[model samples]
Target: MEQKIFDCAIIGGGLAGLTLAIQLADSGCTVILFEKESYPFHKVCGEYISMESYSFLERIGIPLSSMHIPMITEVLVSSVNGNSLTRKLDMGGFGIRRYTLDAAMAKLAVQKGVTLLEQTKVTDIKREGDLFQIKTAQGNFSSKLACGAFGKSSVLERPLGRLTAKSAGEKNYVGVKYHVKTDLPDNRIELHNFNDGYCGISKVDGDVYCLCYLTGSENLSRSGNSIKTMERNILMQNPFLQRYFTHSHFLYDEPLTISQVTFKRKSQVANGILILGDAAGSIAPLCGNGMSLAMHASFIAAPLILDFLKGRLTHQELCMIYEKQWKEHFSKRIKTGERIQHLFGKNILTNAAIGTLKLFPKLADALISMTHGKPF
Candidate 1:
């Protein structure tokens, strides 16, 4: 019997991969997704998504309207020394845990006719002739095309030599996340800044609030390479963070953490594999629109992928157009995020900047606008 070949094989089952699989399957294409972890797992993410993707997610069958997700409309930003500013959010967002959202999207993908393979890791991908050979832990498979949605850091990325980099001598970061029971308004998101780091807190599904932070790797090293030491000595120095840490009921004994998190730009098309989400280009987490950005990449790639599968365009054309569109949509947003992140982290500088932005609310709104996008 001849081997079955899918239209596309997706590696990684996060938002990008799962959403892409659903989109392709909805359009009558065959897709098989490979994920090393099972559904409903936790990830080190802030868990806030810009409203720009609400309608798109619904259009793709996420049922966000029925989920009763928290709608955040205000932002409270504090400086390293606890100087603070509050502003009404113009392009507000909502908070949803990756544990809930990714699992929901995974089920939606399977319902949409995409083959969902959980606990299956893709060991390598090689393009030979016109098809992609996907070697996985469960078994090998072939597809007309492949996508890399294995966000942030992945062992599979090293062989492609796309955006893989050595962490040594690089300015990397540590991301720490927790789901806590805290006293915070569901309609507001708070960002508390400390030396070399910032923490974001907002409500998610049910009564849970997502408390997540990002700090320089050097901060951990300076604290004896201990996450607890770093949080107590560095993060707690901020008055807002200290209060939350002291008062909140932490749901986990140990926080979820990811190290060597770098925001370097990556190629969208590499070695015939289309890259999506943080695997393509990671905006600084300070922007708070990463989930939307990742979903938008799928929105852009879906139709073009269908175009390629239906022989409306050549493979080379698909790669070129997707790269161009990805850059056009996201390059400015990512650059703005990087620039704004630089404005944070320092005590005196952030103090002055927040004071000035507070004095001029329109300027603050404009800065936020640059980091976000319109509803798709």
Candidate 2:
């Protein structure tokens, strides 16, 4: 029998990959998706999504209006000493858990006729002539094109030679997330800074709040890898965080943690495979634009991909266009996020920056606007 070759094979089923798969499948292209974990799994993310992608999600079949998730329009940021600033967000956001969002996307992809492969891990990928060969635990698959949507850190990064010196040299950061029942306002998101880290609290679906934070790995080591100890000793130093931690009823028995979260630069195209989401590049979570950026990349890549598959554009043209568009849309936002991150996580500087922003509210709004993009 002749081997089956899909139009596109996506390595990860997160937001970017799943969104692209659904779009392609809806366009009547053959698409296959591989995900190591099953649906309804939790990930270490802030769970806040920019309103910019609201229409995009609805167009793709996620019924946002029916979900009744919290709509956040205000941002509250605080220094370690509890000095704070509040501003009305011009393009505010909504919060929804990864478990709910990803599972919905996965189901929609399948409904759109995408070949969904759960519990399948892609072991290797290589380009052979015009086709890309993918080896997975299930079996080998072939595709006219491949996309890498596996987020943040992956075992494939080393094999693909994506670990650049800048990424390797940076101080590693760890992220932790928990779902809790708290008194946080549904219309607001709060960011509290402590020593070497910051925490964000926002309401997601099911009337629960997602509390997530990122800290340098050294802080975790110093606390003997005890998340509780790190929170008690370091995070509680901030009065805002102290109040929440002490009062909230945590939903999870243990927090979900991910390590080696790098904000380093990455190439959009690596080894002839298109990379998406955090695989391409990650903005600092402090900006709260990562999810929107990921979905936007899919929105950008899907049309170019269709053009290539239909022969309107050559492979080289497709790659060139995607790379240029990705950079044009995201470079400034990523750079601005990096600069804003520097102002946080330090006692003196964070306090000073908050004080300055509080005095000049318009300046705070401008800085926040720089990290977000116009709705797509």
lDDT of 2 by residue, 80-184 (tens): 999988889999999999999999999999999999999998988999999999998789999999999999878778767887776345778999999999997
Off by over 4 Å in 2: 165-169
* Candidate closest to the true structure, highest TM-score: 2
- lDDT per residue for candidate 1 within 1-376, as digits (tens), equals 7889999999999888988999999989999999999998999999999999999998888888889889999999999889899988888999888999999999898888899889998888999999999998788999999999999888887778764546565678999999999898889999988998889999998679999999999999999999888889999999999999999999999999999888877889989899999899888898899888899999999999999999999999999999999999999999999999887787888899999998998999899889889999
Model 1 segments more than 4 A misplaced: 163-169
Model 1, CA-based lDDT: 0.91
- Candidates' C-alpha lDDT: 0.91, 0.93
- Residue 40 of model 1 has an lDDT of 88
Candidate 1: 10-residue stretch with minimal lDDT: 161-170
TM-score of each: 0.98, 0.98
Cα RMSD for predicted model 2? 1.0
